[model samples]
Target: MSSVSGLVKTEQLYRSQSGWLQRAFAWCGWENGQVMANIRAGRMLTDYGRYHLSRKQFIFAAIAAALVFYMAAYLFYHSALVSIAAAGFGIIAPRFRRRSLLQQRKERLKLQFKEALFSLTSSLAAGRSLENAFLATLDDLKLLYPDPRTELLLEFQIIRFRLENAEPLEYALRNFADRAGIDEITQFTDALAACKRSGGDLLEVMKRTSAIIGEKLEIEQEIAVMIAQKRFEGRIMMAVPFVFLAFLSLAAPDYMAPLYGGIGYLLLTAALLLLLLCFWAMAKMMRIQM
Candidate 1:
């Protein structure tokens, strides 16, 4: 019995080490060939603590991409070859859609977290213990969010659970920050941990942190509003080329006939590439990283 137990422990240790090595190799870019394998296996990395797309979402995105690609190909080139080529875009579209969803979720989480900090600050100011403040903030967030499933609310519940399990407050907070994967949350947690360790006034710290986060969010909103017009213009510009091509094909098909064949196809492809590059550049310029 003792020998069997020793053998089992040795095997477990070897398997654990092997798994660690594989992950290390993946992180070091030595497993580039695994990209498609990872995606196919649904092992792709996602935003921390966020759910990946459901099967329904995947199917919907695929159908939508197919329709869009087919329509765009027919509208642009009116050739079977072009339509087939456009199908390749459908392969790439799902990843982009998934990324867009992740980004929107992150934005929502960021806003919700800011509100939660405000709630926490208020509770602390009112003489609540840190643990109680977390609990009180959950109620405040439920009022602000109204959805029990919102990211911050769920995170608060996790923190509460950990605290109830006899974990230290700072440990619970650090775990929350790790799962959040947001710089603001990480910074807040770091400050909180430091304050708790040093026996500083947490109420004052919460107040200052909440104020800073609120101000940053305000500035971000202002910047977004300021760039709204530019974003609109960029979209209009992206549409102009397609609209012009459609008009030319409709009004004077004979004149556009040359563009449908041979060297014209290459020139058109180059022009389209240039247009996409310009649109991408404009979008990057309009984006305000906060």
Candidate 2:
């Protein structure tokens, strides 16, 4: 009877301890179940413009940023408190990095789409059916991309599969555009759908659309080249303040000694904030939306 009572008490104690641990983790934002759910959702939600970072990449980025910020903080303030505070920014750095990567990937995908349209136009003009034209475009893309898994190629494969399964070409194109989430792609898909429904000359329509998209992409490239110098200047300007401060600290430590503590720290903080705001404003100004 005593053994049975002891066993029951032990089991109850274990359950209580486990429950307490779960609550503690939840309070600390470390709920295992929730974290797993978020990771899974992030993986599953990845689409054209949404990229997922692997666990290795995320950990590497965080550690790299933490170390860089820690060094920068120590260099600027020579204070452990400021270094720790700056290290905290590393937690969010990976998110910004991932967003930048996604944007670049989208831009590359858009350019690839423009190239695919040229092949598609040629195939259609050469008397291939729309479905065959996509297949021909895929082949051409394979030659240009040298990758069997490029985004445009994958999209074309999906559309080809849908067409083979008896789905309407218009439906497939619409779905592709929706997934792509690019204004240019959406416009092309709309035009294609309208042309198909009205039984218009698809070859001419595709040729015209391809020409327009190609011209626009060329113009955008030219604009990027024209503004490249301005972008470089903006970036240099953003770095000038930090570089100057670092120089002052190294070249004349006594000169910057007064900015080390007390009200000096507050002033330094305000100055850093102002510099960040200026950098952000300059970056926004340099970003030309095409």
Candidate 3:
């Protein structure tokens, strides 16, 4: 019986060692198949303590806080109101910061995408395959953009890992689209999958797509220039009043004090808010869908 127990222990140790070896190889790019499987299942690296949180986690956190507040209110009635409010605020603070960070990351990603696409197109035109184009684009992005470039590179690494795991090219491409949330990428992935399955002409498709993308980018640049001009004009117009008022107040404080303190403040605040709303609306309207 003791001998059998010892043999079982040895087998378990061997299995543990094998698992460790598999994981190490996976991290080193040897296990692309498993990496692909993980990506298709939406299990990527995440920092719950910092930027991103799942919707389910957010809901659960809110529910937990609500339950805690309900219990506190029930037990102490009015005495624990302050504590309950404080606890609720604490619970919501993390959610707010998480959302803010996600938005910031998203904006940075959007800002970098035009250059990324141009780089990819240039690489494709130079006779590089799609995967190599993306890899090259990642390097170009790292040099041109900021932190979001690093995020995009990490995504490319994840996709490469997935490919190593024996995941199909289509599966890996689909995973890339889902992770990036980019419609252009999703369309490109779908098109590539179709071409692969049917043995179609990928080079032609890429060339045509690249030309169209360049034209659209040109139009977008024109729109951005117009918007910037409008924004600049608005700023100058808004500043003119303040500048005139400063001169007036400094030149004749007794005469202009009431006007500057009352009507000027209210109008300035209203104008600023209106300008911000307009800017936000214009940005949303100008967002190109893919």
Candidate 4:
């Protein structure tokens, strides 16, 4: 109880120290209304596993999408109107980008969570109680991820705050698992909660749990390494058709001109549709959902 109270006081002091700096930034207009809104959204970002793309991220993605689609369409149909119309596909770019960001965030969380489990398990083996082990894990986490804003570190802050407020470790761990949306973390939490309820040996259960989850993550890392080259090759292959068309148009404009109208236009449309379908299929196939 004394240690927990001390932690709460320390947290309060740290936040109070940072508050004036934040207020100064706000007053100076360095963090204006729009920046403040995004900062609020970013804080809310911790509440869920899904990512919300900010205006800037979405706008940049949309512009890149529009440019790529326009270039491909112009290469296939030499018509300005058709190229501009195709660029409207930019509307869907943010959705795909958000999914990609969410996946990346979750993967990073998975790796960090694995390290956290190791630290927690070590603390338990060293004779700390479960709650103490959690607090001790924070020290290890700080060393492992120097960034103050790293997602797992923020999560530990939340968990520690809950602990300071006298919440049970089980409930805090459950909330973390839910927010994290990671299978390994969820399983570890479940196992932990069950062990606590059943008065099972904490050190033994944690050791086994950590070993199993670490092995799985290591396997995933190996698979990712194996598929990395293939994914790169896939991206290069997708760009080949557009590059070839641009080359032909530059080197032999007359040869490519015949394909810019009438039956050639229809053929190009079919080719573009085929290209899109193939691109979609390749993306779906390459995404390993494990």
TM-score of 2: 0.80
Q: In model 1, which residue pairs have backbone atoms overlapping below 3 Å?
A: none
| Per-residue C-alpha lDDT of model 3 across residues 96-180, encoded as one tens digit per residue | 4455566556545545565677787789789898777877887787787556526666666666677667677678768766766
Each model's total of backbone clashes:
0, 0, 7, 0
Candidate 1 off by > 4 Å: 1-51, 227-229
Task: Residues 109-131, candidate 1: write the lDDT tens digits.
Answer: 88898888888888888899999
Best candidate (score: TM-score): 4
Q: 264, model 1: CA deviation in Å?
A: 2.5
lDDT against the true structure, per candidate, is: 0.77, 0.80, 0.61, 0.85
Tell me the deviation in Å of residue 189 in model 3.
2.4
Better of 1 and 3 by TM-score: 1
TM-score of each: 0.78, 0.80, 0.49, 0.84
lDDT tens digits, residue span 11-77, model 4: 9999998897767533322334565486777645364566666667777887899998899889988
Where does model 3 exceed 4 Å of error?
1-133, 136-149, 257-290
Candidate 1: lDDT over CA atoms? 0.77
